[model samples]
Target: MKTYLPQIERRILVRPNQTFGILNYDMDNAYPQRMLELVAQSPTAKDCWNKRAKFIAGNGFEEQTLGKQVINSKGLTMAKLLKAIATDKALFSGFGIHVNYNANFKISSVNYVKFEDIRMGDTDSPETAGKFALYSDWGRKTWKNIMRNKITFLDSYNPDEQIIKEQVITAGGWKNYKGQLYYFNPEVDDYPLIEADSVWEDFETEAGIKIFNNREVTTGFLPSTMLFMQSRREEADNSTDIGSGINTPSQLEKDLGTFQGAKSAQKIIVIEYEDESAKPEFQPYAIQNNDKLFESTERSVEARIIKGFSVPKELINAEKASGLSNGSEKKEAIREFNDNTSPDRMELAEVLEELFSHYCSNINPTNNWKIIPVPANVADDVIGVKAGAAINQLLQSSVPTESKIATLMYAYGFKQAEAEAMCTP
Candidate 1:
């Protein structure tokens, strides 16, 4: 006996390309493109991805440039760069920034490069790789005939002062020299997996279930019934061999096709036979109790996808917040998510600060770099009182120090350390 099962397709399959001198992101060298397409198809997954990106970016940088508001000739600002990199990092677990240098070997400008447009240079080992390849059509159908002028080779980001000066001197001028690339990857050598990779299959499953439900509804939940009809006698001129069985489609079959969709719902199907003993038999397949079919599976898949993203459900779905008695569910969710993503924000800010301090003179490093955290946006319960007003009132009250600390920690969105310090005697 032959058995069949549903086939599932996965996108991430890293390999090296000797011809192009770059590491293929996947089998087709388009893992990022594939992941972008997949996420676009799933509503829940896309929402979670957007949320992650927003939380990662938070507010703009804490310190501003001394003289220049824009970092590059293209007018890219620090805030815009942060938003673009945060979006890429949230989706691909990696991002790229193109760094340019002037003829005097001084850093000139920087721009954001799409993660999908970059590939690691192929080498004996990732550590030894010193180049990166950028091509926009890596996954497009026209990739095979991609124009040579469209591809660019860039040097990997090297903070070593000696190495950079040596390379600049050897190249003679910045015009002929390949620009530098600052590629950030959470993983060291291997390509980083997407944020919610473990639940990617669930993305497909959820989409499939939704499509199935829509189709069933379109057909008005019609039964899967089969019709059996005896052979009808043909005229002398139309008579053919019975054993041939190569009969053309009957009128009944033609009618059935027209009866299959929402437009044909509630219409009656009639069958007529010439011989009394040749009546047709209509047999309905086992009628499934499909009212609840895949309902639990859909919920399970949705939960798994959200869990993979590490975002609380209340944050994703505002409707769920209506059930909370204290109205603090969303506030708590925002605080929790911000805390969870603090490391990502810190990593990005530190890298930018380091790069600016080493190369760019306009940015002030001593001012301290910080990416503002996502606000809890919780309103005060007392309508007339403002944010700090309630805290002042609580402090002046006769409440115990521990009670005041607890109120600050829970009622307001303050960390334990911060609340403790604020309430200290």
Candidate 2:
């Protein structure tokens, strides 16, 4: 732990669910052990890599049969990808140096806890820092090593609150609240965070830089670094144990099993394309230059956006600033208003009818490109919106700039011709 993490800085996301998870090396600072050879391979990766292995593997997972995918750069399991490069020199040297993707932010960061903390959800009791007990055919060897030697399996519990307060996540049996930390309990979902008592130790932070403000120099982790640190806690319970030896650990990218990773979140869906048309590179027949697209880390990407046609000069941070560490009681924290308003999960029939009727009225059939309320790209906030609520809101907002206007409308809730008309100028 003494060696400074080259291009690595931890990611901390503060979302409505108050979620936080790891966002491994940003592409610019990204270097892969095995895929360094493939660097010249994929230009679409003019973006980044999986940094930590959770690269997915499945039959035709990234298959060409899926259609309209960009250059089919073969994919791999995050674990296999990592295992191959962990020993490669090119991987070490290029620790964090790749071309920038969004270029929205000046600096980027990576996390180390994925290497330091392994977690387990206490089925018996999901309260306090519940420790792991041996419960598998993997033998006692793996258990013994992990307990004392292997990096501690942290629960990956709430860190934002701790980050905000700069206080110990757990003090005795207590979890922290507004001015205090509280303890764990069975009935409470909001309180009693399951935290390991001892804070991670020997974890060192050193300043190293590949480039800074157009020049390379030592610096600190900055930017709105918030990621969904789901930490495979969900995937662990669903995983099928296959490995017998401790060293020959199960690869993070098992052929078809769910693992602890970002895509595991049901809310975060992926719509991966095996062909170029489905890819971000080649514009589809329906797309125009003004349209915008966002990529999800999941195997298949989900469309949850509508970017403004003309770039809005002002960017706003409408995110709730109630603070992540606010230890509110379970009863009080339940969202009273937003009980169930999902935009992502709406029915298309209703949407089509609405749009179809609109077409019969206001649309100009002569031109499809000149229209109001055209689909815009998805924004981060809408991603958190419930499936149905997000969809309806987007159509009504009709913000324009989405790559797929008809499909999102039909799938969620919009009229076909009117929805098309919505896209026409």
Candidate 3:
């Protein structure tokens, strides 16, 4: 068992203000009584001693407390001695130190003694150490008092309240539960059982799983896979202030879209322009890392990776798609432009191209340059020439060719405009 000693220390200080006055007189006499009062307030001091008696030679709590052990075993009375040191300030009021108890009793070496013993005066004692520990000791005691009755686990054995309550004391003590006072049954009405500790029900496929509702579910248990449940408690901490970061509106605007699974992590692209009046006005890019949201709008077609790697784990081509061809981000953009609402083919096509073209405008051409939305062969009824042929011939136009290729790349992945350069060449 881990134990803690009262937080106590030993030290010697001589004050020039009251070196040999009434202060010295009080230090030598008035401290022991005050030390007695502090120990008398320890309700659990005796209980702690009973829990660990065989180790020391003494009876009752005081004899076992570090101070008393220091006294009875070593014949030292630092508690009274500490009182002498604090004689001038009533209870050592001006010093930035205090002592207190831990809710969980401790058994360790805690002492408060000065540096040197006076040859012309007298020796130090545990009474003085006790005086110093008194500082934090009292505060710790009160805190422990407030935190004493928390519930850690209640049989919650059967998801049934009746069984949990009947077994509360059996499962041990209640030391960390709070909020709603009931657990409901699994089958039938799900209404809470009055006064029952908790109810067992098969919430997830496992049998006899114990669970709770109403408050936060922070703790859980598994009993031979036969019975399972969780326990929770209200929070008791605070956040610290220490940073200079601030969030802006533009950063959050792109999280408003859906995603495709098989990928994890979402990326939104925002473009900052010294001049937003360019002909294209603005470009949009989005990529999502979700596996459960991929599907077709109306039909499907055979597609292939014409030139680059597959979707990256994260999207990094948004600025390029939005018309900022810096090319440093060479990794294949992991964004997808799935049109679920089945918008008009031309409309969806336009949207997809705008999204990708804006993204590619930022890819690193010499090193990381790439293309995506792998060209697809839709073997269905066509508008004019074969679907594949029409796009092939179209992309075979100019260096900064028609918008179809850009739109197509935007809709799927981003590839460089080297295709347009190829067509014109």
Who wins the TM-score comparison?
Answer: 1
Candidate 3: 10-residue stretch with minimal lDDT = 298-307
Candidate 1 lDDT: 0.77
lDDT of each: 0.77, 0.24, 0.24
Better of 1 and 2 by TM-score: 1
Considering every candidate listed, which one attains the maximal lDDT? 1
Would you give me the overall lDDT of model 3? Answer: 0.24
Give the C-alpha lDDT of model 2.
0.24
Worst 10 residues of 2 by lDDT: 201-210
Model 3 residue-pair collision total: 68
User: What RMSD does model 1 have?
Assistant: 11.4
Residue 136 error for model 1, in Å?
2.0
Off by over 4 Å in 3: 1-146, 150-152, 156-412, 421-425
lDDT for each residue of candidate 1 in 1-425, tens digit (9 for 90 to 100): 99998887654666777667788887877777777877887888999999999999987666655323578887987778899999998888789998877655557788899998988887765532777889989887565665656778788887666777776766675567776899999877678889998888888887888788888878777788887766665423234458885656556666877777888887888867767678888899897676576888878888998998888887777553322222466777888899999998999888787667655555664556788887876522333245467788888899998999888777775778988897777
Over 275-312, each residue of candidate 3 has an lDDT whose tens digit, in order, gives 43421232334445222222221011101111111222
